[model samples]
Target chain A: MDVLRITFLRIVYSALLLAAVVVLNFVMIHLAPGDVADTIAQSMGGADAEILAQIRADYGLDQPFIVQLGQYIWKVLHFDLGSSYYYNRPVTELILERLPATLLLVITAQTLALVIGVVTGVFSARRPNGFLSHLVTIVAFFGHAAPVFWTGILLLIAFSLQIHWFPVGGMRDVTVTGGFWAHSFDVARHMVLPVFTLSTTFLALYSRLCRASMMETLGSDYVRTAKAKGLPMRSVVYKHALKNALSPVITLAGLQFSAVISGAVLVETVFSWPGLGTLAFQVIVARDTPTILGILFFSALIVIAGNLLTDLVQRLVDPRVRTGQ
Target chain B: MSFLLKVENLRIELRMRAGVAPVIDDLSFELAHGESISFVGESGCGKSMTALAIMGLLPEGIGRVASGKIWFDGEDLVAASPARLRHIRGNKIGMIFQEPMTSLNPVYSVGEQIAEVLREHQGLSRKAAWAEAIELLDAVRIPNPETRATAYPFEMSGGQRQRVMIAIALACKPKILIADEPTTALDVTVQAQIFDLLRDLRRQTGTSLIMITHDMGAVAEMAERMIVMYAGRKAEEGPVDKVIAHARHPYTQGLISCVPHLVAHLTEERQDLNEVPGIVPGLAEFGQGRCLFASRCARATERCLTTRPEEIAFSDVHRSACWHAEGM
Candidate 1:
């Protein structure tokens, strides 16, 4: 009963938060310089004032700020993200079309980063001053220092230009004629560089964080007690210390999930992957107000869902949290 | 008779940024089968470190047994391989620490933590271990063993947590249990309850105990033999009643006087704390040839500064390491 109540409250809270997020994104984008009318006029080779006014009127940009924001919120509540100014299609339809690729890329990259980071972190933590530990630290330093785009370009140069082991860009081969398996293989090949590029920074963060957390937890009194219990060192570390150490890492991962989505913009643009990140980049450049707002709203929902999942996982793993203490 | 556990000239050194230093200077003691002993000392006197060293759980790359022969059941623990030591640690020897709150992994329930030991050492099936865990909880005097079994460490009070720790330590029914100031972090009333529980458990199981504490009152109640430690060295060792009644070392004498309830006169009348005057010397000053307690000793003589005193026997079981022992 309590769990049901708390979950219901959480959903209601998320709904309210989403509404606020929509309003905030609308206000911030309005405050930024340039509007869809200006971009449209510029695209039409510099329109006169009459044409600019007509474009503004056509897109409802000429309406009062409060009236526009009210209408937008009402439409959002009705599941109608206004049609894209550039694409002339429903903003939701465009985002939906691109959502799957982004989800696949983000989820894959995150899982890869988390798994590699935690494994290496646990390995490094076992012998903190060992050669392998130092190597992990050095690699994490390099991962954090390099920019995502630079890493992407470097992987492109190495894997595509020099060796031709994988495709240069995009998600799948246009020339591929086979069915699902071939298409998937082609997509997977194309994804290797982009996923690696996007996940490097997160991987670096998780590994370093997990290492530090593991070291501290290993020193905790309970770990010592576990050792005193004559538990083999393996159980003493992995079973006793790792769970406590992971809570913080999981929390950071959840917070960073949104950043990963934003980070996808650079990776997607670099690799020309057909994801929301590419759509977002194009929409920003085109000043497609409805599409931009739609993307932000969806990203907010994804991040909120990610946080909820993290909380649920933490509750499952940590009894303290399970008991709501 | 062969002793159940014995330590001969045990020395523990701590590696620090500056250099290595002896934290536990040449120390020796013995625990007979089912014999309860207490190591009483102020902080940094190597009481807990001795326990850690015995369990082979010293701070990694920091605290190491410099030289020692910790003989347990005819096996020299210092020479024991890591695997051998690990086998002996929770099977033959159990340990509980001071901070009950932090000493338990918060993620696991009290029952699970207890079950873990049974599973690890006894190789009990998961269901069997879990059943044994609830029984252990009940044995430790925790109320509602069934429901409380699923309760996490945070849900329990400090006393209850300590009881859980005790349950975990005693789960495998090890030959010896090392309790390093187990009750220090609990409330005064809770402290007495925990001690009662320990005494009852020890009596039922006949498990020898090595209690490390500074509370003289607790020492008198919980231990038959007490070794008062000063600066990582045994300052006095004897029957608790004899030593507390006729304390030859100034440090031990001061410690006993500090406990108001133990001193009948002080319990009736309010007074300022009867505390030992100086602090336990730091690691840098340890292992010096001179008496580490000299600076703080009220009866220190010139000889105390030049050479450390050796253990001088007052009786068959009572001993003190002070140049002024004879006079005292």
Candidate 2:
């Protein structure tokens, strides 16, 4: 009953946050120096002044600010996000087409990073001063400190270019038409580098967070009590210490999820992957207001959902946090 | 052979960057089967460290048994392997710490916490452990064991949590129990209740207890034998009544007199409080040549400054580590 109420409250909070983000995003896009009119005419190789004015009015850009804002909000409420200025297609359809690809990369990368981070984290905590622990810390330190692009480019050069172990770019070979499994296998193979680059950087963050959190929990009074109970070291660390340590790690995961969405834009652009990240980059360059706002709206939901998941998970794992005590 | 636990010339050192400092220096004691012993002293006097050393729960990379023999169940614990030590720790010797709040994992239900020990040490199945846990909670006199079983640590009061801690500690029915100031964090009324519960449990189980506290009232009531610790060394040790009535060391006498006696008249002017004036020296001064308590001892002489005092036997059961022991 308590958890249910808290979760309901969180949903309400997330809705409010989403509403605020939407309004802010809409206002900021309008307040920027240029608009879709300029980019549209620029692509048309400098249209006549009268034609530029016609295009601006055609897209409702000439409406009063409040009128435009109301129309946009009402359109969104009716699930009819406006068409992309660049693609000249409905924004929803375009985003839906690209959503799965980005999710595939982000989810697969996030899952891989989180699992390895948590595992190596607990392992390093178990043997804090050992050679394995030391090696993990040093590597994670450099991995985290280095730029994500630097890490991606390095892996591309070494693994893809040098050894020729994986493909260089794109989801799969465009010409190689195949069955479901065959297509998925090809995509999975292509995923090796981008996913590796994405996962390793955050894997470093998770490991460091896990190690530090685990170390702190390891010194807790309950851990001492567990030891005095004659529990084996494995039970002491895993059953007793890991749950407490994972609390902070879970919160970090939420921040990482939203952070990774934006991060993916850069990596996707580099890899030429056909995902929402790539879509976001292209739309932003074209000053395509509808498509960009639609992407921002989706990103905001993902972040809100990520935060809600962690809050629920944290409450589930720790009764103290759940009861609000 | 009649003794359940024995320690001889035990020395524990904290390895510091500058030098090794002995926290417990050349301490020796013994506990007969089903007997209760108490170590009473001010904070940082190494009473708790001795408890940790015996339980093999000393902080890693910091504290180590420099030299000692903790003999229990025909095994020298100081020389015991990690595997052997694990076997001995919870199965034969149980320990409860000072604070009840932090001593329990807040995430676990109190019943689950108790059942955990039984499952680990006794190899009881989960169902049996849960049933036995409720029974143990009942034994500790916790009200409504069934409902309280599912309650988390935050749900319980201070005395109740300590009862849960004791329930966990005593679940395996170990031959010995080490309670490090188990009631210090509780209120005075709760303290009495916990003490009573401990006495009742000990009587029923016949488990030898090693109570570490600075509370003289607890020592006088619950302990049969008491060791007075001063600056990490035993100042005077004897039967509890003997030490309280005829304390040979000035530090011990000061500690005893400092507590306001209840028998004094309510109308009479309160006696000026007695205090042993200096502080317990830091780790750097541990195991030094002079008497560690000499600066605060009313009986201190020039000899007390230069030469460390050896144990002076008053009887087979009583002894004092003070140069002017007989005169006092």
Listed per candidate, the RMSD to the true structure in angstroms reads 2.4, 1.8
After superposition, the stretches of candidate 2 with alpha carbons farther than 4 Å from their true spots are: A175-179
Q: Which window of 10 residues has the lowest lDDT sum in candidate 2 chain B?
A: B260-269
Fraction of true A-B contacts recovered by candidate 1: 0.91
Classify candidate 1 by CAPRI docking class.
Answer: high
Off by over 4 Å in 1: A30-65, B261-274
Candidate 2, residues A52-78: lDDT per residue as tens digits? 889999998889999999999888878
Error of 2 at A27 (Å): 1.7
| Candidate 1 similarity to native, TM-score | 0.94
Q: Per-residue alpha-carbon lDDT of model 2 for B193-215, expressed as tens digits? A: 89899999898999999999998
Model 1's DockQ?
A: 0.83
**Interface RMSD per candidate (angstroms):** 0.8, 0.8
* Winner by TM-score: 2
Error of 1 at B67 (Å): 2.0
Q: What would the per-residue lDDT of candidate 1 be over residues A1-325, giving only the tens digit for each residue?
A: 7767767788899899999999999999999999998988888789999988998898888999999999999999999999998899999999999999999999999999999999999999989999879988998999989999999999999999999998899887788998889998988998899999999999999999999999999889899888888888889889999999999999999999998999898999999999999999999999998999999999999999998888778777776775667
